[model samples]
Target chain A: EAGVAQSPRYKIIEKRQSVAFWCNPISGHATLYWYQQILGQGPKLLIQFQNNGVVDDSQLPKDRFSAERLKGVDSTLKIQPAKLEDSAVYLCASSLGPEAWETQYFGPGTRLLVL
Target chain B: AQSVSQHNHHVILSEAASLELGCNYSYGGTVNLFWYVQYPGQHLQLLLKYFSGDPLVKGIKGFEAEFIKSKFSFNLRKPSVQWSDTAEYFCAVFSNQGGKLIFGQGTELSVKP
Candidate 1:
């Protein structure tokens, strides 16, 4: 079985620019998650979607960050007018279900650098 | 707010040496704990998880974690670590009620041959 897939393994942009990332979850997985990992810090959840419906996104900065899971298969996260602090690795993960016992499979991640 | 804490930022050891990594979480309700490892240029992979029942949970690659509810801690341990075990390890917690996973600052482990 193939793992979660993400596009644009890396990107570099100046501050105040906009950027977007794409993610394709593993087949048959029902839950998708997006996380941001700053240097020397653990990955922090940005948003979560369960079959096209948002499960959680309290940590997401609504003013600048937005994400959507279209058709419950692919997801896109966007940051408009990015800041230097937005420089981080964006990781996508998928799980078989939303249950607590389910294990999440992660993608290679998209590293973004905002100058 | 829920949070996970990894006590060590980095650790160095030789092959065949014992390994133990500390993790502590702050949550009053039920939570699911996990340990994830990321090798150089590799994605994050699960090492172990603890849900209920036995406190000692074993995972892939000779790794195990002991969950102590009283202390709100889940610490990863390995009897004998190989050089291949060198990686960044993160401790995470999932809130059963909120349906969110929170990760701690990673601990980078270096093993010498």
Candidate 2:
């Protein structure tokens, strides 16, 4: 079985520029999540999706950050007008279900740097 | 608000040394705990989890963690560290009511051969 996949392993952009990261979850997984990991910090959940519907996105920066999981298979997280604070790694993970104890599989993550 | 905290930010040790990483959570409810490891250039992988029953949980690669409910702590331990065990470790807790997890600021372990 293939693992969760993410694109553009690394990216660099200037402040105020727009950037997007993509993710393709493991097949048959029902729950998907996006997390932001600043240097020397653990990943912070940005959004979560169950199938094609969003389950939670309370931490997402609505003013600039948006994400979509169309058709319940792939996802895209975008940040318009990126700021220096936005420089971090974006990780995508998938789980077999919504169970609290279910193990989540993660992708290699996209490292973004905003100048 | 639920939050997790790791006592150590970075640790350095020689091979064959014992290891212990501390984690504490602030949620006063039923919860599930997990330890995840991420080696350099690699994705995060589960090391072990504690859902219920036994307070002592054993994970892959000879790692173990003990859950102390009264102390609100879950600490990861390894009897003998290897160079290959060098990585970032994260402690995460999930509330029984919600499936989402709250993670601690990770600890980086570097084991020198």
RMSD of each: 0.8, 0.8
On DockQ, the leading prediction is 1
- Write candidate 2's Cα lDDT for A46-93 as tens digits: 999999999999999999999999999999999998999999999999
Model 1: DockQ vs. true structure? 0.90
Weakest ten-residue segment in model 2 chain A by summed lDDT: A95-104
DockQ of 2: 0.84
Query: How do all models score by TM-score?
Result: 0.98, 0.98
At residue B20, candidate 1 shows an lDDT of 97
lDDT of 2 by residue, B15-105 (tens): 9999999999999899999999999988999999999999999999999999999999999999999999999999999997665888899
Which stretches of candidate 2 lie above 4 Å from their native place?
Answer: none
lDDT of 1 by residue, B1-113 (tens): 88899999999999999999999999979999999999999999998899889999999999999999999999999999999999999999999777878899999999999
DockQ of each: 0.90, 0.84
Query: Whole-model lDDT, candidate 1?
Result: 0.95
